[model samples]
Target chain A: MERILAILVKDRSGVLTRVSGLFSRRGYNIQNIAVGRTVEPGVSRMTVTVDADPLTVEQIVKQLNKLIDVLKVSDLTDEPAVERELILVKVKAEPGRRSEIQQMADTFRAKIIDLSPDSMIIELTGSEQKLQAFLTMMQEFGIKEIACTGKISLLRGSKVTCDMKI
Target chain B: MRLTGAQMVLACLEAENVEVIFGFPGGAVLTLYDEIYKKGFKHILARHEQGAAHAADGYARASGKPGVVIATSGPGATNIVTGIATAYMDSVPLIAITGQVATPLIGSDAFQEADITGITLPITKNNYLVKDINELPFILKEAFHVANTGRKGPVLIDLPKDLQAQEGEFYYPETVEISSYKPVYEGHAGQIAKAADAIKKARRPLLYAGGGVISSGAHEELLQLSKMMSIPATLTMNGLGGVPYDYEYFLGMPGMHGTYAANNAINESDLLIAVGVRFDDRVTGKLEDFAPRAEIIHIDIDPAEIGKNISVQIPIVGDCKLVLKELLRRLQPVEKTNAKKWCANVLEWKTSKPLHYSQEPGDYLKPQFVIEEFYRLTEGNAIVATDVGQHQMWAVQYYRSQKPRTLISSGGLGTMGFGLPAAIGAQVAFPEKQVICFAGDGSFQMNSQELATAVHYNIPVKIAIINNKYLGMVRQWQELFYGSRYAHTSLDGSPDFVKLAEAYGAKGLRVAKAEETAATIKKALEIPGPVVIDFQVDPEENVLPMVPPGTSIVEMIGGE
Candidate 1:
């Protein structure tokens, strides 16, 4: 079981360490972490997704929120949220097959960032489900390399995290 | 008045209160050298750029600030790498400035060009290559900022030859905006409270301290908390002096070569409070058995350090300074002088062994006596750097570091060929303070090219070369348990150290008598420039209280 969490923390050295430390100590596999500044002064927003059951996620959220540098923390897995990930895929394509791969990429809505004589680099952005679908469709073109930014997320509704049910 | 990048080098240094520098000049950096002469600052010339870096490192550790070294491009720039890497591993703050080939020559691999910034990137906490003249001031400011802040480490600045020669106006800034560089200074209160509650409840509790306590200036806080809770203490190699060495509850060192009582105490403890230390392998022998029964309370400045090598029951991640202060605050109402019965047992252990070892007369020289005399002659005031080998072990075993930052060595890297140059940097960093290099005969040969650097700078550093006529440490291993099959351990064919020192224009001494040891060391320090004393003794002598490789704390040999 995997869950997403939103946390507001004061931007400081070792806060990420403390949060990640909590999960690791509990044997939780953290899949991704994205940190950025929030609208509130001195506050930074973080969305961390981890491969853990609801109880472990709840424990992590409770522990992270208790940190002096942490302003608030919540499990956003059940909430309406917009989640996205960016990926770069480089494929070893022959000159004869490059145009065919380009046509296939157009269907998946990925853009061609660079092209060499035998390689075509493509960039894609979407939810995990969408990425899986694109990867499955592009497998026919022979995927050679892949690198992804994990994920970054934001709440979908106008309601801030503080207004949601704790 | 506005100045050029070259001129600003000396100006910013002077502004930062840098009184002297240790470095070698070269062609690509001729402009930097030329600008150096424009103003009057003491610059010690070294034969090799490596010597300059060591001297700078030495000076920094002695003075408790960043040591500065300068070098030219390509070979000259690359030579100081060992010294920089040594500083990086030991967590010594040093500012290394190198001259690069012009910006255009970069990536083209022109004459005297090397990507020093790239080569040094991973080793340095932060590094910069000034391609634009306008960025020089900002770059320099950030270089110092990054060097001194958060876990203090070395920072390098590679100045392109064109940038050094360019006459663009320099405007040194007073500030920098690094949103990502902020370090957490406050400890989590809940964790502290929980740890304290655990400490108060623990009957067989242990408090372990490390170098981070000294770095964070939390020695007083540690003392206060320990005294308040009446906790027995153990110190890692870097953690010595976090509290008094003579305290009844103190376990001096706790692994491999740690005191018998300390290791035994750890094995028996029910709860352990580990603070300001990463459970390094040297401290925790065979992690599976280390503190097997004890529930661990780990307080660390870097959260990554907690449970890195050992599991933690209660984890507190915060700056040592901040966490210690919070602990002291919370334990304010508790009594400070309380004691328990375990304290009596530990005091007995401290006195019983105290590193008991003896030298049987043999062909190889004894390093222990040389270190003992080095400490005596200097009155424990000189800053010492050591190259890894038998001599390094002797230095640690025989000498006492009464204060923090007084002893600088390659703890993590265990790097050989570290002594001579690091001592030079130490001398240059603090010209007023004496620096000494405890080098093995074999290890010294590796970096002895810097002897020329010593003469050029005329730094009054003393080098005590323990000549055992063999790669003594390795030979000791071969002698002890390797069926006495000596391979390439013989160092007799190496360069004659006395002649080598004379060639570099420094005083050299070769003494075999124990009676002449103390007086000879005194004279070496009294003499001008750098001096190398080759102390020849029992080549067959071995460091005892030996914990054979991969063995646990319980398995100690030579105690019989």
Candidate 2:
């Protein structure tokens, strides 16, 4: 089973290592993770996707809560939430096939962010499935480089993970 | 008031009411040492950083106060790793202050530089690397708070050399409020009610206690609950003092080397009220078959520990004392004879297959006999710290601890070289109390240099070395299961411990026969200074009532 956890932590040095170190030490598998500052200063929110069974997911949440730097941990796997992942992909482009690549990018609502003499970088942000579909289409054209900001998520309604009492 | 970082550290310790520190001085900690020298702080210079850490841990275990230790950079910091992990595993409250290379040289691999905080991340409950002088006071105070708080464990604060010299305004915080670190102190009312109902329905209820009872000061509450409910009780090795060994229904330490009664009760119990326990594999052999018939209610301060190793029917995340008190309040007292049949059955097992060893006159002294004799001579009034190996198990079997913190041994980490330094720490904590370090020849030699520290401080700690000339625990396994191919288990040419003690300006004695064991211990007890006793025991003796690995507790192999 795949479970997503939204963790709020103090913005301090070594906080990342502490969080990741915990995952590795506990043998929890992290599928993907994205971290960035929240609305509050000196606080960061990390969205982590993990592959584990239901029991393991519960253990993961409890263990994450044990870290002193982590302020909050919410399993948004069963909650109604919005998730997105962004990818910057440079695809090999020739003069003849450029328009076809642009059409595919347009269909996926992606933008051609950077252009080179023989290649172009397309910026795309969407749910995991949409990103995967975009990548499959770009595979036809050689993907020269790829950078992904792993999935980041938030609850759909007024409910916020940080405000949820532990 | 304006104060240098070193002074600020002292201020925080003073604020926390730290009475003494176990530490060693080095180049990186020169500034802190200078402050200590000028300010006249109480410090015991240990021969090794590991000794200092264990000493601090022993002090903490004995005094119920978090112990403090200081070390220098690189090798010094790494030396305390085993000690830190030992405390972390046993849930001992300890604070380790390590001096790091100056901030400017931190990542450049400067002289004697090591990433102590990074290295200790997995071992420490929490740790900090002070990058700014202003954070020193708060970090030190927080280190103490975190170390002693719920599910107590070791916390480290790495101070850079330059920061220790930098002057800053010092204001120790009166309270710590880590948003991520709030501990639940009270169990849920509904859960307590449910547990009470379960207790009422249980005919063969058993109470299992662990180190948490000692850490939370819940021994009295645990005893009260057991008495009120007429329940049979068993203890983990770390929970030795949680219940007096002589209690009528108290089963001996339960695990691989557990007594016949303890293991049998755990196997047959209908309800297991496990408090302050983590269901360690040692305590729960072959987990799938452990207490198969029982419904377990686990109460611990740490939520993650509730169902960590074994499934729990009712999980309560709260202080053990508070939870036990609440359960006691909710349940009406049961009749004294409610579990008459069950209690009789347990007592029968206890008496039928009691712990025993046969040592004819003029035979090599049995380790068990020496411990039992010491226990009788001391009247079970002394605090006993033990080093790891077969001797540790033997002491655990024969020397029954009657009070919390009285049995100070490295339970979780099982680290060798813990006994002598730990006893020194305990002696330092209570100079008037009788503190004995029961060590093996192999274990004593690990941190044996600490006799110098003990002698210098006049800490009259007794060292009773069960000298078997081999790593008895490993040798036992080889003899039983490994075709008797004893690899490096032999301690072939270990130094004469008595000579080593005399060389360190401490008294020394040797007891090769069973007849001299009690007299030697009595004489050592009267020395009023540090003394070491080497008791030459049977080299191949094994701790019995043993449950082979991956087997059910009910299928124990020995002590029939």
Candidate 3:
């Protein structure tokens, strides 16, 4: 089973290594991970997608809680949350197919961020499924390169993960 | 108040009330050592950094205080890795302070520079690399806090050389609130009730206690629970001292080298109340087959440990002492009549196939005989520390420990050279108590240089070397499973331990005959300072009541 964990940790050097190192050391499979500073100072939020069974996920959360730098971890997989992934796909666009790529991007609500003589960089942000669909459609034009900002998520309601008392 | 980083380190130790430290000095830690030289602290200089780490670990286990060790950078930091891993595996609270290269030269690969924090991240509960002077005092305080709290383990502080010399304001935090590391102290009420209900309903209940009982100081409660419910108890290797050996319901150790009674009791048990123990592979041979007839109720402080190996019917995550107290409060005391038949059955198995070894008049000295003699002489009162291998198992079999922390050994990591240094640590913790290091010939020589440390400090920790002339445990395995083709198991080139002891300015004794074992140990105990006794026992002797690897605990050989 795939699960998403929203982990808030102390913003310090080697903190990321501590988190990622834990996954590698404990033999947990990380599908993807996205980390960035939160609104508050000295704190960062990491959205880690892991592939594990329910039992293993419970162990993963408990083990993550044991790390000193980690502040909070919430399994947002089953929770009502807004999840998104950003990917920049540089498609090899010919002059004749440029309009076709633009139309495809428009349909997926993606942006044609950059256009070159030989390639067009399309920026897409949506649920993992939407992004994959957009990439599948763009494959016909040949993808020159692709960069993904794994996954980031936030709860839907007033119940804030960071505000919960340990 | 403003203080040098080194001075602040001492101030924090003073605040923490750390009476003594085991450490080695090097170029990176010179600044800290200089402060030590000027403002004196009780320090024991171990010959090797690894010995210092193990000594600190021993001190912590014996005293229930977080042990502290100091080392320099690179090689020095690496030397203590094994010791740190040992403490980590057994959940012993230890504070290891290692001097790192100067801050500017940290990543440049300067002389003696190593990424100590990164190296120790996996093994340590938590570790820090102090790059800023301002974070020094708080980090030190946090290191101690993390090491001592929850599921205690080693915490390392990699102090950069420049930071140790750099001056900073010293304000040790009175309390630390690590949001990520708040350990649950009380078990859930519902779960506790469920556990109580299970216990009440059980006809043949067994209590499988582990090192957690000692760590949480819940041994008394454990024994009380067993007595109140008329239940029998079995201990793991680290849990030896959790209950008095003479306790009528004590079924002795359970697992690979466990007694026939303990293993069979578990096999026949209706319910098992597991306290403060991880179901390690050695304890649960062939996990699915373990406790086949029982419903397991596991209570551990660490939530991750529960259901890790064996699924439990009831799981309680809390401190063992508090949970047991709650459990005791909830359940009504039962009369012995309730489990009389079950108790009689267990007692029958215990008496029928008791741990025994034959020693004829002209036979060579048996290792078991030496341990039994030590037990008689010490009267189950001494703090006995042991190195790994066959001697360790025999000590577990023969030495009856009556109190928590009495039997200290490398239960998890099984580090070979742990005994001598650990004994030194235990002795340092209690100057008046009798401390003995029951080491094997292959094990003692690993950190034998620490004999100098013992002599210099006059730490009267008797070393009882069960010189079997072979790595007895491995040889036993080869003999059983590998066609008795002993490959490089001999310790033939081992130096003379007694002469080695004498050269280090310590008393030395040798006992080659069965009759001489007890007298020699008595003589060693009477000596004022550290004494090393080399007991030449039968080399072919093997630790029995064996459970071959990947087999069920009930499937045992030589158990009867």
DockQ, 0 to 1 scale, candidate 1 = 0.08
Task: Please tell me how candidate 1 rates in CAPRI terms.
Answer: incorrect
Compared with the true structure, what per-residue lDDT tens digits does model 3 show for residues B1-560?
98888998899999999999899999999999999888889999999999999999999999999999999999999999999999999999999999999888979999998888999999999998888889998998899999998999999999988888899888999998776778899999999999999999898999999999999999999999988898999999999878899999998899999999999999999999999999999999999899999999999999889887888999999999999999999999876565889999999999999888988778999999999999999888999999999999999899988889999999999999999999999999999999999999999989999999999999999999999999999999999999999999998889898889999999989999998887788888999999999999999988889999999999998998
> What does the lDDT come to for candidate 2?
0.92
Taking chain B only, the TM-score of every model is 0.91, 0.99, 0.99
Tens digit per residue, CA lDDT, model 1, B471-491: 888898898779999988997
Clashing pairs in 3: none
Clashes of 3: 0
Scanning candidate 2 chain B in windows of ten residues, the lowest lDDT window is B331-340
Shares of reference contacts reproduced by the candidates, in order, are 0.00, 0.74, 0.81
| lDDT tens digits by residue: candidate 2, B1-560 | 89999989888888888999999999899999999998799999999999999999999999999999999999999999999999999999999999999988999999899999999999999999998898888888788888888899999999999999999988888887787888899999999898999999898999999999999999999999888888989999999989999998898988899988998898899899999999998899999999988999999999999888999999888999999999998888867454888889999999999998988898888999999988999999999999998999989899988999899999889999999999999999998999989999999999999999999999999999999999999999999899999999999999988899999999999999998887888899999999999999999888897999988888887859
Select the stronger candidate by TM-score from 2 and 3: 2
RMSD of 1: 7.2
lDDT of 1: 0.77
For residue B107, give model 3's deviation from the true position in Å: 0.7
